[model samples]
Target: MKSISRATIGLTSSVSVLGVVLLAVLVYCCIHFWQAKQQEETANRALHAVEHLLLKPTSEYSPEDVKHGLEEVLGGQGRTQARVVDSRGNRMFGPEVFFNGEGSIREFSQVFETELPQLQAKRVELAVSTVDDERFLNFISGIFASSIVLWILVSVLISMRLIRLVLRPINRLTERIHNLGPRSLDVVLDDHKAPLELRPFIDGFNRLLGQLRENREQLKLFNSNVAHELNTPLSSLTISHELLQRRKLIEGEDLQKIVGDHLDELDRMARIIRSMLFLANANQGRKLQLQPVPSLRQLVVSVAEYLEQLAEDRDLRITVKSDATVEAETELIKRAVSNLLSNAIRYAQANTEITVHITLEAERVWIKVSNEGPTIDPLKLNRLFEPFFRAEEGRSDTGSNHGLGLAIVAAIAKLHGGDVFASSENQVTVIGFSIQTKRQSASG
Candidate 1:
């Protein structure tokens, strides 16, 4: 047999169920109708045989002989009820027949009356009735039960087989697609055996992936070109700043002031470039590529030691504590710590304390920088880590700040799978960061 698909199975199963149900009802009706017809025909034959036999009988034989012949003719197949009576209505023979309705003895004798008018005859009759109807009732119940069980079994088998067949092509297609990697971006998802309805959806997904690949290539090229172009101008600016510092256009105090101003500007530019590089490296998943370096304690100490003068210059005191190991790119980690220190030193009240802590917690390292400063707007805090985002843009020219410092700090932290947080209340503002530790085997 050809295998039926799910749709056809459903149709076939439904049709079979309907046919069986109808057939059962038809068979029951047919049996009742056929048996009734057969009983009537048998009764007619017996009446004819009895009239012919009885007419010869009473003259040549005894009444007992006629009765015995009639009884023998109508024996069991199904129960048969009968009666025989004389023209005056006296009972002649047969087992007792329950008198039902207004049935008359003359009407019953009419069986042979049509064939033998005015002839002496014995009236004969037969009727089919439900003596015990429970057999038919049991038959109907069994048919219903069997039908229900068969319907469930067949439906389950059909649905299961259909579900498996439908999913087979899809499962195969999924495996083929998953086994393909970035190396097979050019390859198409197999449409062979793919359902007609699903092909369009699959095609759309593949087209989307193709577009994403093209966009990524364009972005990579653009990033490279922009970095190169910007570096050229930065180099020229560096050389000009150096040559100007060497010139004697203005002497002593004036020369020192000009160089300081130019140095700050140069520092700002350098920071922007460094921030870009850190962000680029961070997102590219370069965490494992960073060299393992001194513990968090040493990194903090180094930054504090360098920024100690700037702290003192601003009448601020600095303190460092703790010893904890961490894995990170040294230069970037130092830059991040220094930015936090510089930000603290810049914003702290003129003669207050700046506290720096290096903490070792289970599985990681943390750096905390705290200072007494005015509270920052919480709304501004969220965007504080975005590139070139300056909250103090409203500040006077003399008090202006290059806002890329905190952004670069965040970038460097992320490059090492770390993060920075800021919190402030009253006169205290805290800046903190955490980093994961890398342990070395004692033998290494």
Candidate 2:
């Protein structure tokens, strides 16, 4: 790829070319105007000299004398020619007016009736050469050409220098980035100290670095959590298997119970692996199979009914309110709603009401599940949707809640072109998500 310096220099050169062309045109116009004015003044001077010669009585000066006076007035510069002629087109005096050089000429003529009645009307014609003016114009043009060439050279050198100065910050940034390793992700670029033009780039880079740092930390935490979660059940299964192998004899019912426990542990592991895979795919932006659900309220009600037993266990009553129609992936939306309802049921106060409210707006359908429970810490509330992130109160006694519920909900919401939100205040926690309605989804 071409360097920015070269690109900038090329652009400067193009502009200089245009400026030089314009300047040359202006100079040419000025020189042409000066030449025209000079020619006019020369004509006026010759005319004045001819008038003076005519002031003498016609008898006092012969044609030859008038010619001589005209010659003296016009000078012997070989640039001007003058001749006196009769009205009959016959030359009266003065040398033959002719030119052999290649140059422009201006002609002036004056017809006068002399006092000699016998003499026909005489005409004075003057031809002025522009070869001297052409030579001067050539000299000026040469100087301008040389100056333009020099200016272009100087401009290129200056442009290169300025480009270097302009790109110095970028070069420093590049070096800083080059020296960075994964362990050094905490380092941040100082945008405040950077030039205004580079601040946006610096700020963006700093934000990216921050995100990388955050992701790295989350990855470490996630790995640790995964190991802990899997290790508990694996250890139990291993112990059960080892005990069975060591037993010399075992009763049939006892064997059956042990096998059942093993199956349960295996199921839990399967569920964890499945949830992790689902999240991985979701993060990769896997496409959803979408369809129109005529009644969002009904969907929530179905999810609530499915989990009614769990709510009953907590002595909580699940109630769904409002109605909305939305375009969504049915299974994923159901999963998201189920997760919200399950989470609410887990934390809801005994004998309290858990409400699922569905609101239909112009473009979106919001599903909110609010339950009376201990207030979630405001600082950790936002992070509840991140995988493996859970408040102290959220550590389930049954070991079935793996803290991936809300994360899955968030992923589903994103798939449906929405997001998840949670807020807890006054012993009431509301967790919900929104999905685009049919019209909105179609237009989008």
Candidate 3:
């Protein structure tokens, strides 16, 4: 029932994209700063070289000549416009220069008659660097603005892709849930198409829902069947008691027979109840922890003795043939073999032979119980093991079986990692079970 919000996914994707953009901008800033540092070093070195070349002292130069040479170098290199000034703060050599704009202008007494040396420095100015253009700054800002626009576009694109990737499966699950009623137990999720990280969660949810749905159906069926089975016996007992009450001669052999019939009905009810409880436990996934089982030959021999009287009554033969031991719980295997034998006896002809054989071959133990009965209809063979599935109405009339015996057998076999098969040939039918053999050791 847990779910993630749409806003959370969108916010997470946006943050991830913003992190990537910030990293890209960090790299750009580092490159820009490095290039600016290298340009500053180059410009300083070029200015120093120009100054050293122009001011080198030579024996043939006067002070005036040296000043003129420096000024010529400045003009050639387009360094600043230069000029020499006299004590009167007036230009004495070079082209005239002007200070067109002034900041904090000083009040002067009519053009200096003999100015201070610092004031005369105004005439010796070098290259005045060009004022940076406002238009060029605007162009650089435009580039940054475009980059911001692209970042927003790219982040939107990335968030959209992530939403599609994440929400598609969840949307499918939601649609499936909406379609679901009490009967979506058969719905199977496509694991191959599901995200690997979500596969386990999806699979687990499907399994839990399937189990609950199955349990509901099973409970309904169990109640209906239990009521039907018990009602017949109870009705018979009530009728028999009413007849005895209405009759005068109640202390005779006939009366005892009537009571015996009532007891038999009660016994049938008890058997059905016990089988239902076991099935309920099995369906709820109770475990039967196992250890090494007894020898197959011994188990078969025991079951034959246990069912000997029933076989004798029906004039049937019980046989066991085993070459090796089986690894199975003694009680569970006995129950399974007994169910097979009972099922065979129910269908077998009177005075016919019934053979129960146990054999060990090819690292497996197979126990087969076959009877000389009419061949079972091919279509109904596979369904024989399902709960409450009787072969036909005629076969179940006298025995009055509740029809859970073979189901119990099948459940037991699955618990032990084995199976039962029923196959018919030449007017005879065989039902059998096989289990894996313990592997041999190298020392053996």
TM-score versus the correct structure, for each prediction: 0.43, 0.90, 0.67
lDDT tens digits, residues 1-444, model 3?
434545655576578657756766775666556644554554455445434433444545555555655565445233233344555577654455323332221111112221232223233323332323233345555666687668767766776777787888888877876887766667766677877877897888888887887778867876776787888788898898788778878777887898889889999888888887877787676677555654566676787788889888888877765445555666887888888888887788888888877665576666788988788788888877777777775535633577888888877776666677789878899888766658311110
Candidate 2 TM-score versus the reference: 0.90
Best of the candidates, TM-score: 2
Clashing pairs in 3: 80-126, 80-127, 321-358
List, residue by residue over 60-118, the lDDT tens digit for candidate 1.
Answer: 65656655766675442344456566566665555455335323221223344322333
In model 3, the runs with Cα more than 4 Å from the true position are 1-16, 19-27, 30-34, 37-176, 183-224, 350-353, 357-365, 395-397, 434-444
Instruction: Return the candidate ranking by TM-score, descending.
Output: 2, 3, 1
Model 1 spans > 4 angstroms off: 1-267, 287-294, 393-400, 438-444
Which scores better on TM-score, 2 or 3? 2
Q: Where is model 3 poorest over a 10-residue stretch in terms of lDDT?
A: 102-111
Give the alpha-carbon lDDT of every model: 0.67, 0.82, 0.66
lDDT of 2 by residue, 1-444 (tens): 997789999999879877996889798889889898988888777766776785568768886675567667655357666766787989765566546445788888887776655445478787888878888888888888888888888888988899899889889888999999998898988877679988888888889998899899899999998998899889999999899889978888998899889898889889889999999999999998888787777788888889989988889998877777677899999999989988888778999999988876667778899999999899999899988888765456536788889999999888888877799999999999988755532111
Pull out the clashing pairs in model 1.
none
Among the numbered candidates, top lDDT falls to: 2
Model 2, position 173: C-alpha lDDT score: 84
